[model samples]
Target: MSTDTNAIGLHTSTATQLAEHLNILLANYQTFYMNARGYHWNVKGNQFFELHVKFEETYTDLLTKVDEIAERILTLGHEPMHAYSDYARVATIKEDTHVSDGTTCVKGLLAGYKSLIELQREILSVASDADDEGTASLVGDYIREQEKTVWMLSAYLG
Candidate 1:
């Protein structure tokens, strides 16, 4: 094998591809996180307390993943995108500007979670193919957890 691989022994090209996917994930997570925060603060009506707390918990967890994802990109010898502009340019999860209704916020969150899980699944496939166990495991855990979240959120909507 060529010594031209990255520090973790993955080829530069493979690492680059992984990093690219990771960067996109990072952007989406950041946007999702911000949206959760907005929901937590703005949500009103009968389910307000419940949804506000849930959104807070969700956004806090997202903050942690945002850090982990950036670190992973660094591990692959790439810089994580740091600007809101970069996130806006790349993220598929749109910002929630004015949603305050409890049910509406829940629906928005469900949509974001679904999108994140889908993107993570794609990344998991790439990571599995490249033998990047770290990336695979990270996103695999995310997928599992978010799948459950999706189910619960759907039940909430129903």
Candidate 2:
């Protein structure tokens, strides 16, 4: 195993850990994006237009973020896992099935947002330990976005 000092340079253990964490984050984001898309397509009842539009915006933001996080992993000298199968395996956020209502969808998405926040916190700790200030900053940005999404989704439930 490479020492922390050596890893601090180019090909470090930190990079590898970050790469794995990034893959997990990518998968979570992809799942969230698809779930949001599903909600956008199937939302019904009173607040349909509002919920649909909001879900679309959330998914679109996630779509961009997924790409950015993957690219960042590649920039760190690691290959970003791109296969859907791989994402399904790595993601902590489970796939949604049989979502029947807007409220249910919102609840699921709120859970996902919370999951993402937890994942980002772990990644942030890893980045901080590795002295990867850039990754830490990126994780912070993601945390803010996820928290805001969760708050908005939860508000709809109240």
Tell me, by TM-score, which candidate is best: 1
Q: Which candidate should be chosen as best, given lDDT against the real structure?
A: 1
- TM-score per model over all chains: 0.98, 0.91
Instruction: Give candidate 2's TM-score.
Output: 0.91
Model 2 lDDT on a 0 to 1 scale? 0.85
In angstroms, what RMSD does candidate 1 have relative to the true structure? 0.9
Quote the lDDT for 92 in model 2.
88
**Which ranges in model 2 have alpha carbons more than 4 Å from their true place?**
1-11
User: Model 2: per-residue lDDT, tens digit, 25-97?
Assistant: 9999998888888888888988788888888888998899998999889878788888899989888898897
Clashing pairs in 1: none
Candidate 1 colliding pairs, count: 0
lDDT of 1 by residue, 1-109 (tens): 6777999999999999999999999999999999999999899999988888899999999999999999999999999999999999999999989999998899999
